[model samples]
Target: MKDLACQQFQDTVAEFLIRHQSILDIISKSQESNARVNRAVVKAVTHCGCVKVRAEKSAIPPEATLADLKQLLDSHLDGELCPNCREIIESEMGKSIFYLTALCHSLGLSLADVLQREHEKVSTLRVFNFT
Candidate 1:
């Protein structure tokens, strides 16, 4: 019903990105610190119902195994990999932005347009804003 303003839209998207970046920073730090990596991965798998009630379940695929993923993260950290964890973090964060951008593009909506609409919606809400 209303045309989205560019400044408001960009600010809203920037805020969203900043919040996601903060969460990612915590995860990345945990990975680098080697704290709870195995436990977190295991918990995620179990929560997804991937594990069996019996003693053993199906083996994790080589590529998808937590071990492999951690190795990848570690290699990325060591500078042996072209992009350190920082690059990986950026790429992962970029993914959501890229996906939203693609969807907007396909729907004939500019990011500036949708973002401004979302901003207005957030601002209009009295109790809470970030969403």
Candidate 2:
């Protein structure tokens, strides 16, 4: 079911991406869309004041293990996205995904397959994946 949705999205992107047919265009647009996503999140925190970031260095004890790091670390986010901010962020994220799918289509890659492989890798590796 999830794979179907991903394939559908990829197909839709390939169909609609008439203007940005060039690989350069797809890559640049993908970057722009990603920047928009980051901008939307910043707006939610700064302009909307719906959320606040209280980020600081993690104080990991010398004896802490990899599993314990999960409990020790913090996202540092306070509150939540307001409805308006949430909508904007979702829209921006959709654009990001569209461009990402378009990039995959241009490269003759399957987004669903890529996602599945990554999922399997992360699932198998668990916390050690990052390290």
Candidate 3:
């Protein structure tokens, strides 16, 4: 959906994806294509899905522009206008990155070492349901 909406920048995104494909492919391969995640996590990942279905006045892939992505990524919470939400989200992201790094280290793998094994599959929790 995000990709389709970014069609105007199709070429740019395609090139970026190509440069980043190795990491993307590995992370994708690490997770089972069909598996149930924690119910709460599922809810978060599917938030856009819900919004899409319900016709809410929230952001969709198409509504999102390059500037919005940049704002979300910039380190300054001041840019967000809502500092508390921005801080909370960034904090959660930090914890998630730490969790991924530690888990990867314990498994003798780099963060990019995420690859699915046909014989066994494990859960990867990207977010904690703190909110």
Candidate of highest lDDT: 2
Residue pair clashes in candidate 3: 29-116, 30-116
lDDT of 1 at 127: 31
Q: What value of lDDT does candidate 1 attain over all alpha carbons?
A: 0.46
lDDT of 1 by residue, 16-101 (tens): 55433454453454344343444433443454333323343444566674435443432111112223433544555455454454
lDDT of 1 at 31: 49
Best-fitting candidate, measured by TM-score? 2
The local lDDT score (0 to 100) that residue 129 gets in candidate 1 is 54
Minimal lDDT window, size 10, model 1: 74-83
By lDDT, the better pick of 2 and 3 is 2
Tens digits of per-residue lDDT for model 2, 1-131: 99999999899888899999999998999899999999999999989999999999989999999999899998899999999999999999999888889989999999999999999999999999998
User: lDDT at 22 for candidate 1?
Assistant: 50
TM-score of each: 0.33, 0.97, 0.28
Q: What are the candidates' C-alpha RMSDs?
A: 17.7, 0.8, 18.2
> lDDT at 90 for candidate 3?
57
Candidate-wise lDDT, in order: 0.46, 0.94, 0.38
- What does the lDDT read for residue 77 in candidate 1? 16
